[model samples]
Target: MTPYGSFSFFLILAVLLAPTVILGLQGKRFHTYNMVVSIVALGIIFASSLTQAIALIIFTIWQVVLIKAYITYRKKSNANTIFYLAVILSILPLILSKLLPFLSVVNVIGFLGISYLTFKGTQLIIETRDGLIKKNLPLSRLLYFILFFPTISSGPIDRYRRFNKDFELEISGEQYKLLLYDGINKIFRGFLYKYIIGYSINHYFIANLRFIAHSHFEHHLYYMYAYSLYLFFDFAGYSAFAIGVSYIMGIKSPENFNKPFLSRNIKDFWNRWHMSLSFWFRDYVYMRFVFWMTKKKWIKNRNLLSNLGYILLFLLMGVWHGLEIQYIIYGVYHALLMIAYNSFERFNKKRKWWPQNKLTHVVAIIITFHVICFGFYIFSGQLFHKGV
Candidate 1:
């Protein structure tokens, strides 16, 4: 069954409400029913779907390890190394399942959300290390975050520090009703985007890309455009659905999209499209890379070094999308374009050759859109192999 199917949705709702009801009735003091709820939810997830099972496992292990590492490293200053190692080890199963699909059974290439949940887990570990805030690692918060179900499949990728702040707020009846209705409406709209728009494009406009890949010329470009459009609706739809569901549960998830297609530049596009994921990489991946480079004294000039660092970071970002060579190519291609754009902007600040006119903005927008479409050839995975 799909993660967001009717049965799964109701089951998750019941599971979430169980502990809240129990705790509310038990004099409002902290009750251990949250752990029991988590255990039961884990069982349901494991029995219901393989992807859900993997997600539950990852979440559970992550929570437990975070608590253990904090206890161990609280006294030692270099405890961050241990935490980092644990984080890598926790992500190992997800990485393997994704990169080694051949090793999977019954075509389970990856879990429902190892990609999204991996970010949550990594961010928690890093936040704990940075001393931004300390989570008590209690069962209630763990259950709410991990088995929250709304964001389990897809995510808006909330920050741990902010997430904890939101989670601790008391839920009221009025708030619950508002969240539930808003979430349902969002889910309906997401379905319209995916099933109506994305599916239509895939069926009528593009059809099976494998067939187009084997066919004659001229059709290839058409397939690329259709596929790009399809990808946008499909993924954006998923993100919307996830965020909406989270809202119903009294959680204000970060917005993941902001009219990315209307972006006039690559930087603007990154800021708009999949905003949560981009920011995750920016804060956790790109910034960390810069810190490492600076610490090593690898490049003396911080500005130039940071620019170069972004390029290398995106190259890895590409590979992380998939183990395929084409994904890497796609990442590097975008990274180079971004670096060039940044450099040109910096240089233009010193020269008056460019005009700040609407026509110039329009031209730049067109150029940026075309540049993005060209990289889709590498992203589609068919470009690297002649056969389907």
Candidate 2:
């Protein structure tokens, strides 16, 4: 029962959340209800078709065992080699999931929420290694953590600690009322965004995709705009519904988008768009790469080090999307843009005559938006793409 996509799902979820809200108003923690509802929702989804469901179950069991073992091991020793091995074993199934399709096998290991869950599990492993999650987690609680449904399929990924904090909070009547109102409003807004305008644009794209694919050189502005809007509204709308449902349940899930189109630069755009995923990449991949390089004295110059990090991070981002030429180009394109932007900033600082006013800001916004739109064109696999 996905919270973001369907009217019936919301209706059903609203019924479940009603009792949860009632408990919260009585100053009680509804953690058990939340966990049970989440499990039931996923159970209802995958019960009819147990193939994918079995994959998810196996993956979950594997992750649970790996994390539990790691916690046990960490209690005894923090050996770097064993820690890395444990991390690899935890994510090995996910790696198989992504690669098995190309290996001419059915996607038996892959599941809808695999990537997001891996991120959470990987974070727990890393944090446990760093002494953040100090105590060992029981199997049941860890299952609750990994299977928390609202952000499962597509996430404005919430951290384990944050989810626990919200789970334990007792909402006042006033706050509960406000949360109910805001949550309903957000669900309605998501409906408008995902179904109404986003679907319209998506339909338009489907009708014209073949046309654009055939016509080699005619610039299709409409398709570009349609796809961009569809992408934003659909995913952003899903995020809104997820977050809204979470708020109603007193979870206060992290936000995913924040007026990304108004961003003045590529960096600014990332800060606003699909923010949870972007920040995850930055925090885990980019920052770690830079720190390692700095610590090893591999690259003394900071800017060069940063540029290298950007390449590796975005390259991983591309590979993560898929092993497609367009996806790879998309990642490299952004990496180069960021590198050039950094260089330009360095140069512009020396020459202070460059305009730094409202007009310049407006101009920068326009340029950045177009740049992003062009990138999306690449991402969509519509530009010079060889097709049947």
Q: Write the per-residue lDDT of candidate 2 for residues 290-345, one digit (tens) a residue.
A: 99899999899999999998899888888778767888999999999889888888
Give the TM-score (vs. native) of candidate 1.
0.82
Residue pairs that clash (backbone atoms under 3 angstroms), model 1: 179-248
Model 1 stretches with alpha carbons more than 4 Å out: 5-55, 102-110, 171-178, 208-215
Going through the candidates in order, what is the number of backbone clashes in each? 1, 0
Q: Which pairs clash inside model 2?
A: none
Report the number of the highest-lDDT candidate.
2
Model 1 per-residue lDDT tens digits across residues 251-305: 6788888877677888998899889888988988888878878888887887688
